[model samples]
Target: MGALKFKFLFAFVLVFIVAIGSANIAEFDEVWQQRAAMAEKDAEAAYDPYPEQSRNRAVEGRNSTRRSLRGYKGACVATNPIDRCWRCRRDWARNRKRLADCVLGFGRKTTGGKYGRYYVVTDPSDNDMLNPKPGTLRHAVIQPEPLWIIFKGPMVIKLNEELIMTSHKTIDGRGAQVHITGGAGFTLQFVSNIIIHGIYIHDIQQGSGGLIRDSVDHYGFRTMSDGDGISLFGATNVWLDHLSMRNCHDGLIDAIQGSTAITISNCHFTKHNEVMLFGASDSYPKDSIMQITVAFNHFGQGLVQRMPRCRYGFVHVVNNDYTHWLMYAIGGSQHPTIISQGNRFIAPHNLFAKEVTKRDYAPMSVWKNWLWRSENDLMMNGAFFVKSGDPKRMAEFTAKDVITAKPGSYVPRLTRFSGALHCTINKPC
Candidate 1:
C-alpha cells in the first residue's frame, strides 16, 4: 500500500509540470502573433489615403524645415514661371538682396561705374520708320532721362555701326523680345555701369580669322566659325544676366579689351565653339587683370571642346554645371590668380581626355576644378591624354567643391522676376 501511494504522487507531480510548461508556450505564441499583426498594421498605415491638401502641407513642412536649417528664404520657389511669369526677375531680386548684405559688409568699394548711362533699344512697331538711330553718348546719363531709350520691337542692328553709350546708363529690356541678327556685333567702347538683361542674341558671325577650328573631335573646342553671342570691349561695372546663346563659331560669351567688374549670371550656353572666351589679345596690360564672375549657369550638349579659355586675369567661375564635353573643360593661362570653385563637371567617358600641355610662356595655376566619371563612362581613350604641368594639384579635387546638376535638370526660380519699380515715360517720339 505505501509503494502504490508513492507512484501515484510521482505521476501527479509530472503531469502538473507538463501542464504549466504547455500554458507558458501557448502564452508566448499568442504574444508573438500579436506583435506581428501590429507590425503589419503599421506598414499598412504608411500607405493611408491622404487628401492633396494634407500632402502639400507635409511637403511644405519639409521644405520649411530645410530652409530654416540653411538660413534660406523660399519666397521665390515656384514651378516653371518663366513662360507665364517673370520668374528670373524674382530670383534676381533675391540674389541681389543676399549679395547686398555681403557687399555692404565689404565696405561698398567704388569701382568706377564707368558704364554708367543706361539705354533701351527697340524697332519701330509702325512702318513709318526703318533705320532707327542709335542712342548718343552724351544723352546717356543717370539723371533726368536716365538713359532709358525704349526700342519699339524686335529688330536687328547693322555691324560696324556705332551705338554710343554714355556713363551710368543701363539698357533695360522692354517686355518685347529683341534679336540681333546678321554678322553685325555691338561694340561697347569706353562705357561704364551698364546692364544688358533679358535678350536672345544669335548668329552674329565673327570677321575673317576670328575663329580657329581644331582637327580633333571635341565638343566645345572645335570651332567651325567665330562670333561671340555677346562681346564686351572697354566696359566696366557691367551685368549680363538672363541670356541664352547657341550655335556660334567662336564663344557664346566673349570678354575682351579691358572689360572689368563684369558679372555674367543665370545664363545658358549650348551648341557653341567655346562656352566662354576671356582674353583674345592681352595687348592692353589692364586687360590682364580681368575681374569677372561667371555663376549659376547651365552649359551642355553639342559642345565639343575647351569650355572656357581664361588668359591673363582673375576670374571666379562658380556654381555652373557642365554636362558633356570632349576635352579640357577649362584651360587656364600661364598667368596665376584664377579661382575655379563651386563648379560641377560631368563626363562619363574620357570627356576631358586631351590634357592641356603647360605652355612655355608662363606657369599656369589650376586649383579645385571638379571632374566626375560615371559608372557607365568608359575610357576608350588613352589615360595619359591630359597634358598639364601641374597635374599633382588636379587629383585633390572632390565632389564637395564642385557644383553638379543632373542631366535635363533646371531650376525654374533661376529666371523669375520678383520686384520692379515701373516708371512711366511722358514724352514719346
Candidate 2:
C-alpha cells in the first residue's frame, strides 16, 4: 500500500510539471512572434543603399559582368559574394575602406570607422606601457573620434602591454607589412564601430598588470590579461578581417560579456588551443543578445579545438574552410544557437576527434534541445556533426528573409586572399 501511494504521487507530479512547461512554451512562442513581426518591419528599410528587385544585398556583385571579369582571373569563379564584390577591383588598394562594404551573414550591417581621417603609424616600438609614442600603433588606437590608421612601413610591434582600442577606429594594414607579437595583443573593451584588418598577430604572452591608458585622456589600473590575440569585451559592431593569428596563449579571438553585431571574416587562424571563444562565463546570462558571424576564414594547421565555443548567443559559421583540427570543433554550453551552414570541415586522422561539434557541460537529455543546425556543410575524411533543435521553433526564430549564400565547396576560391595581402603601390591587393 505504501509503494502504490509513492508511485501514484510521482506520476501526478510529472504530469503537473509537463502541463506547466507547455504553458510556458506557448507564452514564449507568442512573445517571439511579436518580436519577429517587429524585426520584419525594421528589415524592410534597414540601411540598404543598393536594393534592386531581389531582397539580397550581395546581388550587386552577383549581377555585375564587368566587375566579375577583372584581370588575372579565369571567369572570376568564387563562392563568397563578399570577396567577389570588392576583391576583384583593380583599385582595391587605393580604396581600402571599400572593404567595409564587403560583408555578409549576420554582421553585414556593420559600418566601421570608414568616415574617419587617416592617422599613419610611423613608429614600431612599444617601449612604455603607460606613455606610448604619439605616432605608434598604441597611440593611434586611443585617439578620440573616428580615425583610419595606416602604417608608414613594415613594422614589428612587440607590445609592452595590451593595445586597447578606442571607439570608432580602423587599423588598416594594407600596402604594408605589420606584426604585433611577443606580448599582449589587441583588446576591445566597452567600445563600438571598429575595424581591424590585414595584420599578423602572434606569439602573444600574458603581461603583468599595470596602469594603462585606454583612450587619449583616461588611464586606469588594469589587471593581468588572458593573452588572447583579439579580445572583445562588451563591444558592438566590430569587424576583424584578413588577419593572420597563431600561437596565442589563450583564445585567438574572444568576444564575451554581451558583445554583439560582430563579424570575423577572411582571417587565418593556426597553432592555437582555443581558437575562438564567444562567451566568457556560464553565469552571465546577458550574453544572450550576442550575435556574431564567422565567415570565409581558413582554420588551418595546428588547431586543437573550439573553432568557436559559443554560449547563449546566435552564431552563424558560414563558408569557412577547416583544414585541420585535433579535437572536436564548434562547442558551446548554455544553449547557444549555432547555424553552421556552407562550411567545409576536414577531419584529421585522429580517431577520437572525428565529431565536428561538442556540447560542453551538458548531457544528452539536456543538450538535445539546443538549436545547433548543420545545413549544406561539406564533411570530408569522416567528419560529422550532431544536429538538434526543433525545426518549427528555428523557423520562427530566423523569420527575417535574408539573402542566400553559396555552398562550402567553393571556399578555396572565396578565401584565395585569406591571410594578410602584400599590396604594392602599383599592383592590385
Candidate 3:
C-alpha cells in the first residue's frame, strides 16, 4: 500500500511540473491577446492616423485607399500608417517619446521608455562587460528604470560580448547614424517593451562565454552568442523598426522560446540568408503562442530565403516589397498560420524558385491542413503562393485578428523609405 501511494505521488508531481512548465512558457499570452484586440481596431481605422493625411479614403476588404496628396508638401512623404504616426515632423528630436505611441501591429503595446528620462549615449566603446560606462549604450539598456536612449553622434560600436537588454528601453538612433557590427549582437532575453529603431546591425560574429551584466541588479555567466543581429528569447512587446540589417553569421532576427507581441517594420534587409526565424525548434510546443507582424519593409537584393521562416505561430506579412529573392521567399513547418496580405513578390529569374511559399519537413497530406493564405499579394514574374487549410476557420478569429488586404500595388508607396533615414536635427525624418 505504501509503494502504491509513492507511485501516485510521483505521477502527481510529474503532472504538476508539466502544467507549470506550460504556463511558464506561455507567460505572454495576455500580451498576445491584447494585441489581437488592437488588430481589430487597426482594421477598422483604414490607415488613417494623422489629421493632415486624414483625406485618404477608406475602402472595403482587399481594396486600395485613395491617398490624398494635396496639402502634403515636403521631402517627407509618410505613406504607411506606421510611418505617418511620427515621421515628417521637425521636432522629432524633442518629441522622441511620441514614437512610443506610434507602434502598430502585434507590438502595439510596446512603449519603450516613453515615461522615462532620456539617456544620451556619448561613448561608443564596449570595453567592459561587468561594469559598463554610464554614458555608453550598454549601461543605458541595463538600467532598472525606463529610458529613452539616444546617441550623441554617429559611431560604430563593436561589442565585446552580447548586449543583453532589460525591459522598457528604447535605443533611438534617430539623430545619429549608429552601427553595430564586426562583433556580437543584441539579445532580448526574458524582457518586455523594447524598441530598437533607426540603426544598422550587421556582420555580427559570435561572442565567447563570460560574465555579463544583463540588468541593474543582476550579473550572470552567459554562453557563447549566436550571431543573430537581434535574438529574442521569451521576450514580449518588442518593436524593430526602420533599421538596415544584413550579412549576419546566423539569422538577422530570431524570436523563439514563446516570444510574442512583436513587430518588424520599415526595415531594409539585404545580403542575408535565413533572414528571420520566428520559432526555434519543432519540439518546442510552447512556440504555438508566438505572433509577429512583418510590414512595410524592403527585402532587397542578395536575399536567398526565409524573408521569414516561421514555425508554430500566427504571422501577418503585410505591405512589404520583396524585390529580389534567389530562392523561395517564405517557408514554414510545424503547422504555422501565415497570413500574407498586400505584399509584392518579384521573383528571381530562376523558374525553380518562383513559388513564394515553401513547406518543410512535411508531406502535402500533413501540411495541406496548415492555414497559409495569400490575399491581394502581387505575384510578379510567375510567383505563386500555395494556400491551404479551410477558409471558414477564419470565423473562429476575433475582430482584432481579422486583417483586410490593402492591395499589393501600394507596397512601393508604403515601403518607399524602408531603410534607416538620414534625419537632420530640425528636418523631417
* Top of the candidates by lDDT: 3
lDDT of each: 0.41, 0.75, 0.80
What TM-scores do the predictions have?
A: 0.51, 0.81, 0.83
The candidate that wins on TM-score is 3
Question: What's the best-to-worst order under TM-score?
Answer: 3, 2, 1
Query: What are the per-residue Cα lDDT tens digits for candidate 3 across 1-429?
Result: 999999999998677656444222222245434533553333223221221221222212323333232243557877777778799999988899889987777777789999899999999999889999999989989999999999999999999888988778999999799999999999887678899999999999988857787777766655567788999877888899999999998899999877888889989999998899989888887777777879888999899999899999888898888988888899999999888888999889998999999999999999999999888788888999999999786544332322344789777777777878778798887
Q: What does candidate 1 score on TM?
A: 0.51
Writing each residue's lDDT as its tens digit, candidate 2 over 1-429 gives 999999999998677645433111212234334433443333233322222224444322121111111144443333466666666566876787888777665556656678888899999988866778899988889888888899998998888888888778889888788998998888887677788888999999876657777666666656667788988876777889889999998889998867777789888888889999998788878777787878878898899999999988888787778888998889999999888877788899988889999998999998999989887787889999999988565443332223344566655556555767665654555
- The CA lDDT at 360 in model 2 is 87
- Which pairs clash inside model 3? 40-400
Worst 10 residues of 1 by lDDT: 57-66
- The parts of candidate 1 lying over 4 Å away from their true place are 1-146, 149-164, 206-227, 282-285, 348-429
Worst 10 residues of 3 by lDDT: 47-56
Q: What does each candidate score in C-alpha RMSD? A: 32.0, 12.0, 8.3
After best superposition, candidate 3 residue 71: deviation in angstroms?
23
Tens digits of lDDT, candidate 1, 1-429: 999999999898667645433111212234334433553343233221221122110001011100111233344342221222333244532222222111100011212232223244433221111122334222232233334443444554433221223334444433445555455334443445555555566666653322111111100111122355566655555666556567754567776655556666656666766677776653445555466656555565667654567666555454445555665566655352343443445553653454421222442343323221121111223322233334454333222212222121222232222111121232110
The TM-score of candidate 3 is 0.83
